[model samples]
Target: MENTLQLDLNRSSHSCREDFSEYVAHLQLHMALQARNLVPNLTQAADSREQLLQETQAEFEKLVSRQMR
Candidate 1:
């Protein structure tokens, strides 16, 4: 009876390990997709923000072009 109980415990542990591995693989896949989706938008947002800053700077600097009497 003790041997049977030990065998059952071993089987349960093996199954749990397999399930954990599968869950990890799924999580990795989800994270990869999330990263892929974010990269392009993040890059584009940074570029757009830079362009806006440059345009605003040019406009503001133009105000300084006039001399104060």
Candidate 2:
């Protein structure tokens, strides 16, 4: 029973990682589109976008850590 529970936990972690990867891909594509559209103000756009991205990444890391636990 304990071993089966551990196996389930491992599988759930892998699935979480897979889902997280897909989510990251979608987020990156959206960011790229926003960057493209902000071409006229590329410098400010890039800065703002990078800040947003960092926040998102931090959150994602926390979420992944929780799933691993």
Candidate 3:
């Protein structure tokens, strides 16, 4: 009985370790996927902001030239 109990405990411990490791790996993969998704959105936002800035600058230059004339 004692030997059986010891074996059961060892199996439970090993199973718990495997479960924890799997959970950690799943979280890492989820975070990586989230980051992968976010990178393109962030990059697009940056590009849009840059484009807006350039358009605004061009409009401002045109206005300044019109005012000078």
Candidate 1, RMSD to the unseen true structure = 19.4
**Could you tell me how far off, in angstroms, the CA of residue 2 lies in candidate 1 after the best superposition?**
1.0
All candidates: TM-score: 0.56, 0.52, 0.55
| Candidate number with the higher TM-score (1 or 3) | 1
C-alpha lDDT of all candidate models, in order: 0.60, 0.66, 0.63
Evaluated at residue 46, the lDDT of candidate 1 is 55
Give the CA lDDT, 0 to 100, for residue 51 in model 1: 68
Better of 2 and 3 by lDDT: 2
Off by over 4 Å in 3: 41-69
lDDT string, candidate 2, 1-69, tens digits: 999999999999999999998887677666655654653422333577776766665575565555444
lDDT of 3 at 57: 50
- RMSD to the true structure for each prediction, in A, is 19.4, 8.9, 19.3
Q: Write the per-residue lDDT of candidate 3 for residues 1-69, one digit (tens) a residue.
A: 999999999999999998997777666656555644543332233577766755665565465445433
**lDDT tens readout by residue for model 1, 4-67:** 9999999999999989977776666565556445433222335777667555544543543321
Candidate 1 vs. true structure, TM-score = 0.56
